[model samples]
Target chain A: DAGVTQSPTHLIKTRGQQVTLRCSPKSGHDTVSWYQQALGQGPQFIFQYYEEEERQRGNFPDRFSGHQFPNYSSELNVNALLLGDSALYLCASSLATGQGWFLGEQFFGPGTRLTVL
Target chain B: AQRVTQPEKLLSVFKGAPVELKCNYSYSGSPELFWYVQYSRQRLQLLLRHISRESIKGFTADLNKGETSFHLKKPFAQEEDSAMYYCALSPLGSGGSNYKLTFGKGTLLTVNP
Candidate 1:
């Protein structure tokens, strides 16, 4: 099923510039989430999208926004990139059920390594 | 605030030896714990979750609410088991916050032959 897929395995940008990362959810999955993993750190939740809307958000600033398309593909947009923003951006997909979104397993993609200078 | 902690940054063990990866969490409400693994050049994937109570790739984790810990254990470590393991926590509820995962720094396991 190709599980989850991400584009542009690696990216480089300068401070104050904006960057966008893309992700395609696994087949039949409707929920997508974004995470940031700094070197030597685990993935930190950024936000989650479901039904083409942002259903959940983390502690990230407003500069970090996202959009989910009807096809279940998502995009993470980070404006005013800072040096600290240089990290591995991960995109995860899962199914949303009546029980709870947390009940379903999240499948992750290979991740996009974003380097902000 | 919820947090997950994996004290060890790196762990080394000889093949066939028993191994345990420690994980501690801090959360006020009930949290669903999970173990995720990332092998070399591979994407992160779920290894197991506390609720399932099932072993995956010979690894099992037991959640102790009193101690607030979920440690992953394997009876006999294999070389293939070498990878980066992360312990994550998800709040159990119906709110939007419940969908996000809180993850530990992760433990890198290296099995020697």
Candidate 2:
């Protein structure tokens, strides 16, 4: 079975530009979440998508948005990116338990390295 | 606000030596803690969770509620154990498909043979 997959292993952009990263969830999984891992730091949650809607978001600004398709794939869009936005964009997929408590194990992709100059 | 803190940025150890990575969390309510690992050229994956109370690859972490910490430990380190280890925490009721995790800065473990 295929695990979570992300596209465009690496990308380069300039300040004020926009970028969209994609992710396909693991088989039998329905929820997808996006994270940003800056150099020398662990990942910070960007947002989570469930039932085609954003279910939870982190401390990120409005410039960061996401979409979850019916097939459980996801897209993370960052508009007007800044130099600080340059980081490794990670995609994690997990099975939603529906009860609002205790999510199962999360499987992460190889991550798309975004560099904003 | 929930937070996870891993004080060590890098840890080096000789093969067959014991290893311990420290992790501390700040959360008012009940929290779920986890340890995730990423080896060179491999995707990040879960190593273990506090709820499971099970060990993986000789690594085990105990949730010290009184101290608000979850430290990963192994009796004998192996060369292949070198990787980036991350500590993560999630609120009690906000997990699963709708989960939002707060992660530490992570510690890079280099086990030398």
Candidate 3:
């Protein structure tokens, strides 16, 4: 099923530069979420997209944004990146069951390591 | 506001010993809790969730509402069990959306031989 797949296994960008990370959700899944995991820390939710609209967001600023395509693929864009933005970006996909937000298991990708210099 | 807390960052145990990773949370409403594990060089995966009351890989977690805690435990630890564990909570979302998860910093479990 290819599960979930993310792009550019690794990336290097300078401060103030912008970066976009892509994710393809598992087949048949309708929702995609983005998270940021700093070293030695659990992933922090950036936002979740469903039905081509952002369903929810975390405390992160607008500098971090995302989009979900009709095919369920997603992208996370960061503007004017700071060194603090350097971290492992993870993409997760789940089915948007009518009952609850996270009713089923979320399949995560291998993650893209972003290093802002 | 919702938050998940894992009290320990690193927990080391000998093979075959009992292991317990503590987690606590703060939320006004009911919470759907889950335990996620990440092995070396591998993507994160769900170990189990409190709602299902099912055990995975010999690991189990019980949610104690009175204590506001959901701790993951295993009676016999194995070296393969060494990994980072995260506690997550799913709260209700506004405007007909489900809230994004709130995750703890995580606990690193090392089952040494």
Candidate 4:
């Protein structure tokens, strides 16, 4: 089975530039979430998209936003990027809501490593 | 707000030795805790969740609400066990909204052959 897939496995951009990372959820999954993982740190929650709407968000600023399409694909966009934005962007998909996650595990994509110089 | 904490930044153990990765959390409401592992060059994957009360790859975690800890433990540390581990927390009422999870700073496990 094809698991979660993310495009642009690695990206390099200058400060103040914008970057958009795409994610294809695992087959049979409908909810998508994005996270940021700094060097030597665990991934931090960014926001979650379900049914084409942002359902929940973390402590991130407005620069980070996301969209979920009808096909369950997701895109994470970061505007006015700064050097601190350089980190590994990970995408994870699960069934909508927290239901049955106790039964089926959350699938994760290989991640897009973004480097802002 | 919910948060996870992994006190150890790095943990080292010899082959055939036991391993324990500590995880703690703070939240006003009920919490769902999880342990996720990321092997070198691999994506982060769920190892186990407290609700399941199960073990994966010889690792197990028990939730102690009184202590607010969910420590991952393994009987024997294999060379393949070397990886980074993260503890996560999802708060109550996540079904409707607030589905986002909070993760800790992660612990890097190093197994010496």
Top DockQ hit: 2
Prediction 4: B-chain TM-score: 0.93
Writing each residue's lDDT as its tens digit, candidate 4 over B23-101 gives 9999999888888888998888888888778888899999999999999999999999999999998874534324467
| Candidate 3 CAPRI level | medium
- Candidate 1 deviant stretches above 4 angstroms: A99-103, B94-98
> What lDDT, from 0 to 1, does candidate 4 have?
0.88
Worst 10 residues of 4 chain B by lDDT: B91-100
Which of the predicted structures, 2 or 3, would earn the higher DockQ when compared with the native?
Answer: 2
DockQ values of all predictions: 0.59, 0.66, 0.53, 0.50
Put down candidate 3 lDDT per residue, B31-74, tens digits, no spaces.
88889999998889989988789999999999999999999999
Using lDDT as the yardstick, the better of models 1 and 2 is 1
Model 4: colliding residue pairs: none
- For all candidates, what are the clash counts? 0, 1, 0, 0
lDDT of 4 by residue, A37-110 (tens): 99977888898887899877889999998989999999999999999999999999887544632214578999
| Candidate 1 lDDT (Cα, 0 to 1) | 0.93
For model 2 chain B, give the 10-residue run with minimal summed lDDT: B91-100
Q: How accurate is candidate 3 locally (lDDT)?
A: 0.90
TM-score for each model: 0.96, 0.96, 0.94, 0.93
Lowest-lDDT window of 10 residues in candidate 3 chain A?
A96-105
RMSD for all candidates, in order, please.
Answer: 1.7, 1.5, 2.1, 2.4
Instruction: List runs of model 2 lying over 4 Å from the truth.
Output: B94-98
On a 0 to 1 TM-score scale, where does candidate 4 land against the true structure?
0.93
